[model samples]
Target chain A: MGITSRTENQGRTIFINVTERFDFNQHAVFRKLLNDAKDGCEFVVDLTAAEYMDSSALGLLLLLRKKAGNNRVELRYVKPSAIEKVVSASNFSRLFDCKAVSPL
Target chain B: MSDQCNTDGSLNLVFKPVSRRLALVVDDEPINCVIMQSILEKMGFETAIAHDGYEAIEAFELLAPDFVFMDVIMPHMDGREAARCIKSMTSGRFTPIVFLTALDDPEEVHACIEAGGDDYLSKPVDPRLLRTRIYSLERIRSLYQKLSRQHDELLFKIAEEQENEALANRVFLHAVSAHNEPISGLDSYSRPASCFSGDLVLSCRLGQGGIRVMLGDFTGHGLAAAIGALPTSELFHAMTRQGRSIPELLTELNHKLCRILPDDRFMAAVLIDIDPVKGEFCYWSGGMPPFVYKSKDQLIYHSSSGLPLGILENYDFVSEVGSGRLTDIERILLMSDGLLDVRNQEGATFSSCGFKDLMDSWASNDGFFSALDERLDQHCQNRLPDDDVTLVSIDLEKALAVLNVSSDQSADLSPEPEGWEWALASGGGYLLDHSEVITALTDTKYLQDWPAEQAERLQTLFGELYNNAIEHGLFGLDSSLKSTPDGFHLYYEKRQALFDDPPPGQIRIQMTFLPRQQGGCLRLVVQDPGKGYDLTRLSELEQHDDPSRFWGRGMQLVRSLADNLIIHPPGNRVEAELRW
Candidate 1:
């Protein structure tokens, strides 16, 4: 539905929380958050509340990687759900650190 | 008071007439009509006068005045009624109406507005107020005219763009499907979310009595995603016609797409090659949904195990191909992910379980695709899918039957009375650089109108014979080096080294076509100058039973396809005869 972000550890790390659907509709906010982040800062994208994701959302994540550099971005709380197949099918695990965790 | 300045020393209003404008004045009293006419004439308007509401309508229709002034009290028809009639007749043109009222009653003014009065003059009719009101109304009217014109232009442009898009879609569809061979037992359905579909389905009859099919889904739908289909189909049909293997075709396709598409865009594809004669199935799946194979008692799934095409350069696609025997499998089904992602009115998807359930419910494979399509329609309630959807069903039994009939018919061509002969000789250095010489040599003008199957068989026969003469005779390389799978690559590496610095030798190929009573005969002779092998070695290769061995299969294949074969002196020369 929307995107929210907060900085912690003196701005060295940023946690981006995506709520509800993660799709092309969230492109603007996601791009702004990525643009505003400081250089060399690590990013942790939280997908715990996302119920669905589409191909364009995957494209956005690729764009984020292109801007943040390799290994500087990590995806946390990717539930072992239907959307996981889409992510794994594209071999996204080879490009990013994807941690699949159980839903609370 | 002075005309240029009032008592307060403010500048007086100067009226400048851009063009001559007409004004209509209506009143029951003569004094009132004269007063209005004097004010309008001073403002540079040519005036027309009407005595009552009846005359006012008549004068309006005749003059088509730019502006009108109507008294509140009149005979025959009241000014309010006349104002309504005049406004209706204007027909989208802006004509400002000013009502002249003697009484200062707000009720009368409200009634005047209800009858389409633009503005009103109170009592004696102030000239200054009328001048300012007229100026503002003219500005508003011009603005409305500009907006209406723009609205019409926008509508026209949209229609033109749609027409162009439809024409382009027709051309694109033709390019994608024109080369498709209508082979039986192959059924497919594709629907796009927009004017253009990114899903591509291509099937071509293989030159060697089989069929090759590829179903690919690009990154997204519509025109941007469909652009890659043009080159993909062209390459596919050309390569399939040349009798290339599945792995080789996939590798070349991957290289072509990677060079053209963007970084994030790629195609998820499944390629299947069926050889009914050998009862073999070879498939390669990359980043697509699992394909299903339904047998007599069991259903098998083959999931993708490699990245999609165009994602990485230098992809080793040969290792990704999986091969199996067509033992009990009756039919195979392939689909894009869009089929599983289709959502119903309740926002629930038709997942893999639904697909499997439908397959189980079917009693036989005869109506499986129709049943699947019906189920999909029932689940989604005729809703257009969010992405492009493609489904392909291939019946193995039907395909085998068709293959058998076609192979038998290839030999049924009527006898021809024409005869021709051709010969070519090339040095080792020239042959190494132009390894495709066999294709050129087989594709002569004399064979242009022959059946494709016959022409392709001749090409295969020529390829094997030429390779044997050059590699075994001229280069003196041992066929035993290709006994193991890894040794196959090593053998090629040594052959490539020899090609770099080839020995001094020449290969001469001569072909003669002779007329016959039933069909024609092609006699091909290939000669080379090198140390010939033992005559006993040829007999051992003819009876080699291990079909898996890659080294001696070339001579065995030649023997099977040729009607007559003979090795000339020293085994450095071979002749093959084929009847069609």
Candidate 2:
């Protein structure tokens, strides 16, 4: 997967777009992007263009959520498809503000 | 090179030759040949003499002697060449050749050995040396022969064992790999990692016009693990066609597997029963991978809440049942753990998130299975996976068309029965497992004379109607409680607590089997005392776009089964008519 980022809302909200399959292969790029994330900054992961994700990717999200734990930076998910079933089943929705996917 | 012998200038050696030793002597000189033959005979061996190198090979082939005494300097081919030929022809046979040498030079002695002789016997042949060489070589030949015979026996045994294994494989395949009736909507692809697979999908038509599909994966994939599939599928098809409930089926499966499977083995499975006319599905899952039910719009899922089948005793196992109403273009997908465990070159398993995301992509497309298969194919590439990967999809809308609900009539469309009237009233002031009450109706004498198919359909209708009366009419329990995980448990517990008294409304149920002039009719009425239900709610649910809601599932099911569903004022008193 390819990761691209943009800052909006006066640099407080950073939206990261993950394209194609999101898996362990994208760990390097995801880690590089995470380094720029600072406290009090809101991060929105846009998976609208993503097609697939695995538990390893969930593990990566877990890693970021833990890292953002001290920052109080709000981690929001945008346009997640029904793919959020795994996340919901695992109770990750309690940690992140998951936007309901558009009905098919 | 001869260190074991005495190293004196004059050879001093003691030798003892065993009787029955056979020897061949090759010499160019006739007199030498005679003398060699006489010495061999004196040593108790049967002698065969060859005059020259050419004669030696010919005589050796005829004699097959155990030992050879060769003159080093001989005619046509010479002793060295003849010894080389004989050694090469003997293959594994240990025929020791000792060269007869008159020369004292060490180089001449070395040449004889390099040409293939085992040792040098100096000539003007010393009888003592001849005896020493012959006796030692004879002992080795005896041991080699015994070893060769034992090797042959082992080869025969291995062949027999392999034959038995092949026969078993054939028998196992014949037993489990037959599907006579193909269900149109149910499609599956199972690629075994080896000669046999631990994954299986079995389908059967239920007596009540429902279709039962069971997808199972055993503990491991291969020949040994595949043995479990035989018993599991046999029980699934046999019991499902007999109109057994999901829980009852699960109990039998668990009982069989518990006795057969090893402690380390268990089957993770999902069993679904779908009624085509009513478009309602009830499922029970145990330890299988998380599966999803997808419609045109939203996705539905229930937690996998029970232990895998075959791991527990029949009485100890508790399987939670989940119900859903199917919408147009509705489908359910069940996958074995092997599908999720598929790893790429980097050794990362296709995680739960990946499966969900992939399913999401298929939401807008009808080729849900194709996309999944292609993506998995690409992910695996040319390398075969180490586990059996299986994916099964049930096409509900398509199955509805294939599963004809109207086919329950007698094949002859026989004249309708003009039987005697009868009635049975159950659940007067006590709460019961209402489904069990209908199940018991199958054994009634009235239905016993009816065609088995008609009797089963009538029983199914009773089950759906009885359940509705108990939950909504008698107890006034809201259907929405079924949305949560423990909602059914709570609803049943509440029903249990109310044993001391009846529901708020007056409760009455009457089942009448009446004979009409032209046909037969079964009239069933269940009236519960309570404020009447809102008719608007039933109408709204009837036309709602999303069928996944918990409300009005049983009513719609009843409306589909009965010829007439009439609700009186307050919607508390309901009447249903079934005409045959």
Candidate 3:
């Protein structure tokens, strides 16, 4: 009922869609999805369906950055449908370039 | 002792006076002497007859007769002369000498009277008159004996009481003499009404950094009031030297006093802890007069906050702490109620309000205590005080450096505990009571040797870490959720709900401390039975941890304080190590 993801271009680019709550409970599922992403691939973490996201969800995003690896991987972000204070406070817009268009 | 007297002040006659009531009769006239003997013998008196005045004096000394009848007109030495000599020989006794007068002449009777005769009995004595006179005089003699006996007993009782008071004074002097070990910045004075004082002034250097000064006044006065100080002083000295917190000291002292003292007795006290360097001051006052911190010329008053010790069963005592620049403080004054209640020759008291005037006039000077002493003495002079009084002043100088002297505070420091753990059910609502947690930690043998400050820091650390594991792991209350206005409330409500009926999970903690040659280190591992967090994220936050960055506040706190912090894979279990 929360998050779903799909791969494209032989997993070179990944779109991770999150729905409902993206709190700590989704950490394991999110981890598996990010670990399988190819190194230096483009990954777009979509939180458009997420109604709520806690600090652990932020932790997951940081992990996603590592699994994606290297600057060439290009960690992109899709803003949640209901903008969370956690996102604004995390400076994720600037840190992961979530607010601008994906460079890749 | 009979007080009944006949007309003309003579008493009624009695039957055979005891052998100890022997009467001596002296007369040169043989018939007169025989008549006197017959009368005295009939009245049950043993009679000693002397023919002349010289013989009368001789018999008076030898027999020490209770009654004497002297013949007024006698040869050799006259009756009057012998009576005078005999009276002096009797020392301080009521041995009465009655004159036997045959001649009906006023001059002769008068002469007999001047020579120490108590009354006159005419020669050829009237039987009734003689009987009345002897009975009345005998009544006076016995009453005098009884009064002398009582005087002797009274003297003895006084000596015994004085000796007991002196003993109580000796013990009291020794007990309160603990104050004699002068505190560097503190000047104090105490005086008792009687030989014993009921006040205790205690000040000591806390091993860490601070001076704890206490002035306690026991209820009432003298021995009963001073008795409580013996135990109070022992505990105060021991605890203050070890540098225990004021709350612990108060709670333990209050508990012991309540246990040992009768319901009617209690101690009114003021306890102050001053960290001169840090400019921190904490105080707990009960029943004593309000305290005033004199800074510059201003007087800031703080009223007492609790009942006197030993009165409450389970006192919820709290100490008030304040911080200000130490250089601003002039002096700190503490006093027992006795100090204020002391009165002058005119019966006017110095009053608690007088301290303000004292501060205004002289607190900044070196002669502050002397000025105060002069004021108290001027008020009371030599007039006895009604209570025991104590006053202490602490001048704000260079941060009470006297306490910086490093004493071997933990001479018998308990070795670090080997290993122990407690597993409380999630349903235990108040299992994590901070005091209980602190007690549990301090109860360890190794923790006992740890300095109080260090022990306190660890208690705070454990509290934070354990709480995080239970809340974030077991309860799964999201930290980021708190960003919302209602999130904190909602999180607490959910937490309380879990306390009543918690999910199937357990929080287990194991601790292992190792003694290093340098010092020691403690390793604490806490685990919760819940889906663990991703460790890669924990390291991510740790790498670029910004304190202002909100979410992982708890983890940030735990990681920063601990020397080595490791969150195992499946992040439900975390280990932290602290080195000392």
RMSD of each: 17.2, 21.0, 35.0
The per-model lDDT (C-alpha) reads 0.76, 0.68, 0.68
- The reply for model 1, stretches above 4 Å from the true place, is A4-16, A26-43, B1-168, B352-357, B360-363, B366-382, B404-580
Q: Calculate each model's fnat, 2 decimals.
A: 0.24, 0.00, 0.00
Best by lDDT: 1
Candidate 2 chain A TM is 0.75
User: Which residue pairs show backbone clashes in model 1?
Assistant: A1-A21
lDDT of 2 by residue, B449-550 (tens): 666666666777777766667667767878778767588678778866764465433344555565566456777777665666689987787776467654
What is candidate 3's CAPRI-style docking category based on DockQ? incorrect
Judged by whole-model lDDT over C-alpha atoms, candidate 3 comes out at 0.68
| Distance from true location, Cα of B497 in model 2, Å | 62
Order by TM-score, highest first:
1, 3, 2
Chain A TM-scores, candidates in order: 0.88, 0.75, 0.78
Model 2 DockQ reads 0.02
Q: Residue B347 CA error for candidate 1 (Å)?
A: 2.0
Regions more than 4 Å wrong, model 3: A1-104, B1-20, B24-34, B47-150, B175-180, B220-222, B299-305, B319-327, B344-346, B350-381, B405-580
State the local distance difference test value for candidate 2: 0.68
**How accurate is chain B of model 3, given as a TM-score from 0 to 1?**
0.56
lDDT of 1 by residue, B1-580 (tens): 1131122232123333543388898998999878887877777788899988889999999999988888978889999999999989987677888898988889999999999998887878787777777766667666867877887888898776566556547756798888898866788977665666677899998764578889998876555565688888999999999988988898899999888987657788999998754557899988788988887778888888777787667888888899889878778888888888888888888884376677674426647667777888888787888877788888665554332111212222323336665555545344433345555544446677667777778888888988888888778898888988888999999888887776767676666776566567888888887777677986787676887777888888898889899988888889999997
Residue pairs clashing, model 3 = A2-A19, B16-B44, B414-B449, B415-B446, B416-B446
**Residue range B7-44, candidate 3, lDDT tens digits:** 33423333333423688988888888788877667666
Off by over 4 Å in 2: A1-104, B1-169, B219-227, B262-264, B292-294, B297-304, B314-318, B328-330, B339-386, B404-580
DockQ leader: 1
